[model samples]
Target: MGAFETLEPEDPRQVGRYRIVARLGSGGMGQVYLARSPGRRLLAVKVVRPELARDDEFRRRFAREVAAAKRVNGAFTAVVVDADPDGSPAWLATVYVPGVPLNEAVAAHGPWAARSVLALGAGLAEALEAIHAAGVVHRDLKPSNVLLAADGPRVIDFGISAAADASVLTRTGSVIGTPGFMSPEQLVGQPIGPASDVFALGSVLAYVATGVGPFGRGAPHALHYRAVHEQPDLAPLPPEVRDIVAACLAKQPHRRPALAALLDWLTTMDGSNEAPTLRLSEPGWMPDSIARLVREHTSAPLLHTPPPALPGTPPETPRPVPGTPASVRPSAASQPPAEPPGPTVAPEPKAHPAPAPAGEQHEPVPRPSVGETHSAEQRTDPATPSPGHPSGRRPRLSRRLVLLGLSGTALTAATVLIAWETRDSGTPSTDPAPEPGGKSSPDGAPGTRRWSFATGSGVDSSPSVAEGIVYVGSNDGKLYAVDAGTGRQRWAFPTDDHVGSSPTVANGVVYVGSQDTKVYAVDAITGRQRWAFPTTASVYSSPVVADGIVYVGSGVKLYAIEADTGKQRWASSLDGLAASTPMVVGGIVYAGTSFQLCAVDADTGKQRWAFPTSGGASSSAAVAGGVVYVAGWEGKLYAVEADTGKQRWTFSTSGRVYSSPTVADGVVYVGGMDHKLYAVGADTGKPRWTLSAGSEVSSSPTVADGVVYVGSTGGKLYAVKADTGELRWAFSAGAALISSPVVAHGVVYVGSRDKKLYAVYA
Candidate 1:
């Protein structure tokens, strides 16, 4: 079969951020699409059938299977990058391995030579070892799941697999595996384990070695009967491999040799005095005909343009404004009308409006982009201070002279203002000119505290800033909005349960999740609850709002809800509890559970893929340039492909990692329980430097103006150079600090277990 087929019109143009290029194939579970990331990395995206997604039991099973598959990171296995199990049409994405299935290869070229068969056995055994190590049992290990790559064989498709430690999704006495390759125990609906996989392995090897099944051709029932009661016809197999295959085909599970033992046997099949490891490093590991077939299959184009959209599904169009003439309406093919011929005039800032009542909707005001200027004639509130002025006073100037000057040099002054703003906006400012040495500037001399805000309980939630207001959640069951300049609370919204999730502010709304199993959207200015969506369990994962959707995790489910109305768009069940905050970028939401980091379609709630780690992951992900940087609780930081979930590299630490990672200027900064902070290369995962802290470093790091700011469990906050990890300054808060730091207007804001929020100088 061809590696890829042309996509039909009904195929999605894009799933999450990945663009669909072609159709890989369709199966009972889903249709697989050849897709590409924003960085042009190829991925195999599988969109599950709608019926399967709606089945609650099936969704749970799929989630568990995806998690287990991600944990299997073997050289000879396809890696899962992302997945969403609770979406309307659940999906998953895996690394696009370019190889032909073993069945196809063997069918086209006949049986493989003894050496090739031995090598294949070793590679597949190693893959099985990895899978079993992750507490997973691949119940169905047929030839179709084995791909003959140039380097070795890759095992794919863990759909029917189950994690040993997880709850069983299948019913007792249910026959779940394929009939032809299933072990005798599996055929009788008995408890299956890793040994079951060994039996299937033998069947596959027998077929590859002699071009016939060990049980011989028959109906599925007949084959089942033979597998259970009759011995395999191994007479056609070569003597060199016959004994090993016979051992694997042992009727009893315990009688079958372990994968390790089998691999050792395969390595010495040549009978050399020196034991040769079956690394498949030697040329000619594959038969010449099979190798040629693999080359031809892999050499085909990885991606192809999908067919055009089908009829009746017109392309997107901008909505027409009320009272606009039909003749003047802009069409999809037409350009907007040109602006009037004149120099672009800056618009005036509008007056602040009164706050709306609770649950009332309000139109959001448009804000100017960076470098955009306000008109000189714009009205200013006399009682309010301007951005640079702190005294709430206006400077007097000669109106006539200013007007004359503006009229004379309007164009030149506007050009200069735009250029200056553009240049400075590109780089984060260490200190603005107006507050060069003011107390508000974090660059003040060491040992100075700018301000502190105290609450009812310790603050673990990170602060988010918007329009001079700082919004954060507290363990006291309250969401507080404080004045960023004065450190005084403006308002606090109370919840029934403790609030550990950090608040996210967007479009005048503050979204947060609480332990009461609810996600709340409140007015950013008034702290009045607008709406709340309830989940089945407690919510600890922080909420992220993007494209009018609010995403948060409650227990094992991640939900996407309408930001304005609080109506659920979709909910994806994970394999374990999701306590890690999600990071959304390029239409994908990256979140973690106890064992895996999952990438989900932000729009559809479908999973794109998942990446397994050595331990549970509570750390939020950082995405940049199509790569994801995340820390696992196992004391390792991983650089994973944003498109394929394949591990690029890993950096091990001496302690566990609960702190989220921050990526800035090509470096990733993270903290660990080992009482140290690390700076690693974003692309290579190579350590640049490390800084020892007084205690465990669980607080996530933040970067601003080329400086890294992070807090430690020792209650010390340190500011270091982003590129070198050299300490610039450290402040003692007299208690442990678990809350992450946030930088705004040159000041660093973090909370400590001392029950106080500290604004420290950078």
Candidate 2:
């Protein structure tokens, strides 16, 4: 029975040691109760399904989950105040948040306005970043898991799936997760990490803005299949939101921008800081652009569930209420089809013939060569069935076989087609120019605006500007070089895997790393491989050049090589991995490792000094004013004396700050997982100004022509005044941007998760 079913046998007064005050809700897991602890603190307690509690593996997993939950801090997630996973009938309890789930909020109140949606999205991203940092993943994240608290949305049901132990049971032997919201890998039972939550958040945000999931609905398995193989339907959403969601739903989990990326994108959306407009005006008040979107989305065969009712509040019959104005008529087209019982199952599906083998499905009948083809008129004879059937009618199938196929097999193309038709509303045409004048640069500045060329993928790597040209590699596996002034492609070289490491150009050679586990030096002008260096693991660190030496790290080893010869000079083993590029300054090669900051001699690759850090460092170090500034995976930004390697000061953030720091004019600028770009005093590490992006900020900062430019996972590239970190201008991209921004000539160049490189001018 659904959670809406009324149950009244004097409603249990107590469960275990807690006194039940009221009903919270119910699901497959059993009923939830609003209870109070001995201390009189209100809590939401979920009773486990009887069958699940009896399973040994399930119980063990639940215990493990409880252990994990105990490790989590309550700042970002709903705190687990108490639980009894070992109870005769297991149950867990968390603080009660008095508000409707986001799903219900949207259903009862209409889709959130863009700014409100952005706020919600940003909050979720922040929560995910925290969860991931704590080494946990919220496998099931939908609008229902988000509580719209008075101050901000609170992430609830944390670690619930882990409590289930083994994956949740689904039809067809599939593992867990909501069909429409699960990431591709999660659908296939692959271990998921933070990226999975990022994907789920993308779906939730899409639903918030467009009243539909990113993927159109169908059977659970079908949604799973599409999630792994097909792109999301984002036509109804604004490009700002659509791009980030698309990035989150990338087929390859690693390709999806991390939670930080998504947070940054939402934080940078225009008008995100504005208060949500409350008064529901006319439907027409939603922009004509969006109304056009409504018309298109309404055309699709999407399905949605009714808004959930408040805890302890039974569903009442619909009746016109006095005092509040009520519409005498339906204000819109008929509501979408009611959601089915389980996302995994579909109701009464139509049958379709199985497709032939892949190669034989469409042979084009082996058309004759153009010159020897028959006359057009003769070739256009009336169509007819082939000899086997003679008639077009299909062969009659036995009733038993048909029943079996309908009951047990995957849905056919015909069923998918039906779902597609229903789910497809006309998508608004947002394939327009992003903004007037692309990113620009001015002359005589330390950083000049250069020509920005499209990379067709996320440019997580850094750009190397040399020889009047700039070279960089992309997640798409293509290394591109463009004329610094003209923005024309010089040439591009393709590699075997994601080219996330930036190219280092020197002595006619361009050095780059690839996810393929190899570093290659290519001809700067010709884009032809000159030499290839294989590594035991993938290379994500950009190369730093100094004094005829090229220093780079792959996995956990830092290699110093001869710049012109492409031969190794020395290799040093480090305590942990380094994912950021290294900075070579004053004969000391400074690079960040997962757990420490190491300074090595440029020539011998011998460690000069090392500073131990409790948290891993994922970003490279910035050197200026005799200080080294770097951020870590642990949410702290540190300033170290460049010469002595002694830590000067550290500033803490609510979320991880993985983006590398940019030092300019006595201030250091960096993006944080906390969804804010911070300007800290270069000497003391004190925050000067913080411009909250409302999403993760993973992209490194670039200061050019007096403006500091950076991109956020939230899909926006912001230009702020270097001195005050004041907002100057921002350009929206199609997806999360992990790529560091490049200011050259007069244009700002950055790559986004939307699989497109963007260039905007201020």
Candidate 3:
């Protein structure tokens, strides 16, 4: 889920002194853009939201914090490159750290191993020591705020959290933090300090060691209660670090262990009292899985290389970065080629880049086309950085990452929940990710690749098929429509940020949600946005269209809107964020919330009943045979009565149940992190059969004609016997396949982390 999208009309061409190049993503604070300084240096520029800029008190506090933020120079922290606190619209620029966010990494891959979590803790503890030394309290230190750079995890946005805590916008006494990660002091409005960060550190470690948060997921108020009165659930955590995490989560700030103590425990893991500074570069510093990520993330550009060219096609031309010299740009290869065959993925010899322009400034910035990247020699660095690295000195990052526009996802406790998602129905996703698999050509083994369509970045958002066209969203902030038969682009609709919520099509209209905090309704045929419904938070829940209404969830509310008008029909509040795609069956919209599974009336948008799950419901409810089956982060699958929201039985899995279930012939089919696809009795919640996939199975399974089709992070999609859970055949996508498979007309369609959507022969 990494790549840049071209700038838009609404985007500023220049923010402060940097000339904007491309749009990265949006947050609660404001928009983040990739830009270049006049000296031709790259910078991640974050423009603050106007409302926040208008607050005079906020300006004063922000300036103070920004100045203090400058003094924080830590090995495991992002550098604060620059700031414009007094500008008409405040902005901040820092050397960009191109890596995955900790939450996204954990959810994509799975929890870190015990030792890896310990190593991570040490780095964060050291980072805290530096920030606290600067007298800056990281009020909102959570998974999203921590970026897993190549060398180590970098704690970001530490400067802005304290300013947000003091802001009048959050209301005088309301503290700012994520629901599950906030310390009790922040929840109770007690004075906060560095100790609060330690508490959050504990929560982060628990989440990293075990996928679920320590206190469980729920609404803000519920989290507050649990933080104050309930004990963090550490049952699933590895024994090695359980005590440390428990101490960190202590309700009383004074009772929490100091950073030095935590560091001491970490350094002495091998029984030595010596506290040696940690380096991810050191062997065993992190798991092999994460180490691979560190190598690729730090050594390569955030954008991936383009798919290899096919024979008889135009020569490959790397897209050039705006304002870069034209010599490295396209020449004859720039010409468009004839339409490609219906299905072809041939390899072309690699071509060397042209010479740079005379007296060029530094290296020319190559801007490849969407879904394209430079050659091997070009990807040697993490793009151009202002001397940023996790080894020692960190290139400073601006305000909070989004300073002003920290999308609600990263700003406060306003958002969360995930795996991967697809069109309205089926399961939602959660896990660990590593693109250990390679891109498969048509001539490759297990040659079932009918064709593959690549997007700008990763393809976690599943594909939605409609009228011979497959509609999919990308982390590149665009929704793409491709020819189902030819694998050719039909049209593309761009938003301000990434589009993770899958698309649902009905009545010639495509409905989707974006991290840009808007639900867009576009012409299904033209890819033109018809209207956008704005929300106060990002829309992680995919939209479901039924009758004339579009049912979707954003933040903590489930909304029903007029399909044609883009106007809200009604909004129903929930206990927490809406991460699950809505499932509409029989006039009822069933959705999973942070703490419960909710069934809402399709027309009135009123909750009929909310069945509270022991853990957060990570997947959407699947309704069949009068039963609504759902998966929970607590590692259990629940069989609840569709009509009454009462649990019939709960079957526990050895791992988290992020995959949604599919029922056929009185058996419920589900997959879990245990690397098995389970077939259980629909009525009994007892196992009928299980098929080990050899890797985590986060992709929900689709059942068709006595066969179950499911994708795994192992980079393969397996077709298994519906009755016996025996494998029939498997197709490899060469990357993790978190997107659920869709089967129709004898073809199985799946999206992969490789940034391609594959049409396989079923």
- Which numbered prediction scores highest in TM-score against the true structure? 3
| Model 3 CA deviation exceeding 4 Å by range | 1-140, 143-258, 261-417, 420-447
Candidate 3 local distance difference test against the native: 0.60
What local distance difference test score does each model get?
0.60, 0.53, 0.60
Worst 10 residues of 1 by lDDT: 412-421
- Candidate 2 lDDT, 1-762, residue by residue in tens: 012222255455566777665454544344676666677676677776565677666677776676666566644467666778899778877776554455545665566667656766776777776666655677777766765544456677665645323333221110235547878766444667777878888888888888767765332223443576578888988766777777877888899887665666667773444322221122332334434433443343211222334788653322221111100100110111111100000011111222111221111122222343211110000111000000000010000000000000000000000010011123232322353243444442222323346666555444544455656666577778765545667677887766656554445566666656667766665566766667645555655445555566655567776545557778875544543456556677666655567787766778888765434454566666667766655567788887888889998877655566666566767677667888888777888999977566666666655677766656677778877777776665666655565544455556555555555554
Query: Model 2, residue 476: displacement in angstroms?
Result: 2.5
TM per prediction: 0.46, 0.46, 0.49
Q: Tell me how many residue pairs clash in candidate 2.
A: 41
Decide which is better by lDDT, 1 or 2: 1
Give RMSD (Å) of candidate 1 vs. truth: 24.1
Query: Candidate 3's residue-wise lDDT over 1-762, tens digit each?
Result: 344665555567667777777666554355677767777776677777675576676677778778878888988887678899999679877666666667656766889888788878888898999998887888777776777765677887775655324433333111246657778766544578888999989989998888877875422222444577679899999988899999999889999888888888876663434333545546676667766765665554432223334776432333333221110110001000000000000010121111111221222222223443212110001111111000000000000000001101000001113331222122222221212232233443332666778788766565666567777777677888877666777788888766656665555666677766788877765566677788655555656555566666666667877767777888876654555665556677666655567788777777798776654565655565667777776567888897899899999888655566665677777777677888899889989998988776766666656677777766778889888877777776657666666555566777776788887777
